[model samples]
Target: MSTIVVDHLSKIYPVAVKEAGFKGTLTHFFKRTYRQVKAVQDVSFQIESGEVVGFLGANGAGKTTALKMLTGLIHPTSGRVEVAGHIPFQRRSTFLSKVTLVMGQKQQLIWDLPALDSFKINGAVYGISDRALNHRVGELSEMLSLQGKLTQPVRKLSLGERMKAELLAALLHEPNVLFLDEPTLGLDVNAQVAVREFLREYNQRYGATVLLTSHYMADITALCKRVLMIHQGQLIYDGSLDRLVDRFSPCREVKVEFARPYSAHELSVYGDLQDVEKQSARFLVQQEGLTGAIAKILADLQVVDLTVSDPPIEEVIGQLFQAGTVAG
Candidate 1:
C-alpha cells in the first residue's frame, strides 16, 4: 500500500523587490514589488510502505523544498500531501512522532552535551518508555558503532561520528517514515559506505519508507531501485532507476582506440562522433545501430580496445533540464 501520496503539491515563495540606488530603496518603502517564484509545481508521486526512493535534482531544483513539505517543516502553497495516513503540515504529534527527517548539514544534537544526552532528550520529547528507549538506543548505537563515542560531546567527535550519532538520535523512536536529505554530503568514501549500509539495514529491519535526496550518484544508485527526478521545480520523471536511464538516454556511448589517427570520414561511417583525439574516437549511437557500428569499426580499423556504456545519470538529468528550459 502507498504510505505517502502527493497530489499536485506545489510551493511558492514571494520574492521581495529591492532596488539598488538610494532613491529606489526609499521609494520601495512606500510601494514594494513582489515576484512569485514557484519552488515546486504540480508534482505528484506515490510511495509504498518499505520502499526506498531517490530524489534527484540540481541546485534550485526544489528537492529540499519538496522534502520539507513532506516532513511538515514547511507548508505547500497548494496540493495535498499525505504521509503515513496523516497530513504532514498539520504537525500533529502522532504524525510527527512517526516520521523523521535527517539533514546532513543540520544538527539536532546538543553541542555542549554528550550524544547520549541528546538521545535522552529526544527520547523524552517522543515520550518513549525508558525500557523501549534503552533497547532502541542500544541497537542503534551498536549498528552505528557509537557505543564508546556516545559519551563524547558532539563538538568533539569527528564529522562521520557526529553523523552516526545524528542518525541514532533520529531513529530512537523508530519512525515508520524517514526523510534523508544529503545525509552523507561531506563524508569520505568509507563514511559514505557506512551510512549507506546503515540505511539499508535500518530499512530492512523496520520496514520504514525512506525518501532520500542526494547529489552523489553512488548514494542513489546503491540504495534506491526507483528514482523521482525533478528539474526547475517540476516533476520530470518517475520510474525505476534503470528505466530513468533508459528513457532519458536513448543513445549509447562508444569509445574506440585506433592503431593510428582516424579521419572524420571514417568515424562518420560508424556513428555520430561525440569526440575525437589523435589515435582514438568516441561516438554516440542509437541503440539500434550500436551493434552494426561496432562491427563495422572493428572490421575497418585496427581496433585496440572498445567500451560501450549508458550516459551518466547526471548527464541525462542535465539534458532533461535543458529541454524543460527550452520548452518554457
Candidate 2:
C-alpha cells in the first residue's frame, strides 16, 4: 500500500524585489514589489509502505521545501499530499503521531538537560506511559549502542552519541513513517556505519516506511535500492538506483598500472584518461567497447595490473546536475 502520495505538488514564494541603491531602498520601504519564485514545481510521486527511498537533489533544489510540506511543517502552495492516509497540511494529531521528521542540523533535545530527561518529556508529549516509555528506551538504546549515554547531559556527549540520543527521542513513540534529512551529517566513519545499521534493523523490526535525503551518497548507496530525483523543483527520475547509475553513467572505470611511466597523451588512444599519477592511470571507457579497449591496451602497453568497475555514483549524479541534463 502507498503510505505517502503527492500529486502535482508545487510551492511558490513571493519574494520581494528591489532596485539598486538608496532610491531602490526607499521604493522597497514604501511599496515593495514582489516576484514569484517557484521553489517546487509540479512534483509527483508515491512511496509504498516499508520501503526506504532516497530523495536526491542539490542545495536549493526544493528538497527541504518538499519535505516540510510532507511533514505538515509548512503548507504546499498547490496540489494534494497525503501521508499515512491523512492530509499532511491538516496537522491532525493522529497524522502527527504516525510520522517523524529528523533533520541533522536541527535538534529537539534541550542542550542543558540529560538526554533521558528530554526523552521523558517527549514520551509525555506523545502520551506514552512511564513503564512503556522505559521499555521502549531500553530496547532502542541497546540497538543504538547507547547503553549509558542517555544519562549524560546532551552537551557532554560526543557528536555521534548525541545524534543517537536524538534519534532515540524521535523514535520514542514508534512512529510508522520516518522522514530523515542528513541523519548522518557530521559524524565519523564508524558513526555513519552504526547509524546506517540501526536504521536497517529498525526497518526490519517494525516494517516502517522511510524517505531519506542526504548529500552523502554512502547513506543512499547503503540503505536505499530505489530513489527519486528532483531537480529545479521538478521530479525528473524515479526508479531503481542501479538503473539510474547505468542510465547516467554508461561507461566503466578502468584503472591501469603500467610497468613504466607513460605520458597522458600516449594513453589517450586507449580511452578518455581521467588521471595519471606515476605509473598508474584511470580512464573512463564506454561499456560497449570495454573488452576491445582492454585488449588494445594490453597489446600496446606494458601493463602490470588492470581492473574495471562502475564509476562512483556521486560523480555520475554530480555530472548530471552540472550539465543540467535531467528532464522533468
Candidate 3:
C-alpha cells in the first residue's frame, strides 16, 4: 500500500494587482483587483512504504509547495492528500508522530543549549518516557558520530555536525516517513556523503519511507533510484532515474580519444561534435543514430579510446526544466 498519496492537489493564491501609474494606484486603492496564481497544479503521485524517492524541480517550480502540502504545514486549495493513512492537514497526533520533515537550511536545535537538552524537550513534546528517550538519544548519537558532540552547544558544532544532530532530534521518535528538502544544502563533499550514507542505512534498518529533494545530483543519484520532477506548478516526470534519462534525453554522448590530433570540424561527419581537444572529441549523437555513429567512428577514425554515456543527470534535468514540460 502507498504510504504517501497526492491526488489532483493544487494550491492557489490571489494577489492584488495595480497598473504602473499614480492614477492607477489611486484607483486600485479604492477598488482592488486580484489575480490568481497557481503555486501547485493538480500534482499527484504515490510512494509505497520504505521507498526512497527524489523530488526534483527548479526554483519556483512548486516542489517546496507540494512538500509543504504533504507535511500539513500548508493546506491545499483543492484536491486530496494523505500520508500514513491520515489526512495531512488534519495534524493529528498519530499522524504527526509517524512523520518527520527536515529542511536543510533551517535549524530546530536550540542554539545556546547542548543538543541533548533539545532532545529532552522533543521527547517531552512526543510523550516519550525518560528511559526510552535516553536510550534512543544514545543510540542515535552513536550512529551519527555525535556521542560527544551532543553535550556541546549546538552553535559550537560544525555545519555538518549540527546537521547530523538536527537529524537526531528529528528522528528521535523513529518516524515511519521522512520528508527531506535539500538536506545536504550547504554541506561539504564528505559531510554530504556522510549524511547520505546515514539516511540510506536508517531507511534500511527501519524500513522508513523517505521523500528527499536536493540541488545536488549526487544526492539524488546516490540515494534514490526513483524520482519525481515538478515544473511550473505541475509534476512533469516520475519514474526510475535511468528511465528519466532514457525518455527525455534524446541524445547520447560519445567520447573518443583519437590516435592522432583531430579538430571538431574533422569529426563533424561522424556525429554532432560537442567538444574537441588536441587528441579527443565528444559528440552528441541522436539516440536513434548512436549505433551507426559508433560504427562509422570505429571504421574511419584512428581512436585510442572510446566510450558512450547518457547525458549528465543535471544537464538533462536542466533542459527539462528549461523546456517546462517532459519530452521524449
Q: Candidate 1 residues 228-313, lDDT tens each?
A: 88888998788888877776677888998988998887688788787789998988888988899889988989999999998677
- Name the TM-score of candidate 3: 0.85
After superposition, which runs of candidate 3 have C-alpha atoms over 4 Å from their true positions? 15-35, 256-281, 291-306
User: Which tens-of-lDDT digit does each residue in 77-175 have in candidate 3?
Assistant: 999999999999999999999999999989999999999999999999999999999999988777788878999999999999999998999999999
- Model 2 residue 185 lDDT? 91
Error of 3 at 293 (Å): 5.2
Best by lDDT: 2
TM-score of each: 0.85, 0.89, 0.85
Best by TM-score: 2
Using TM-score as the yardstick, the better of models 2 and 3 is 2
Error of 2 at 109 (Å): 1.1
Poorest 10 consecutive residues by lDDT, candidate 2: 319-328
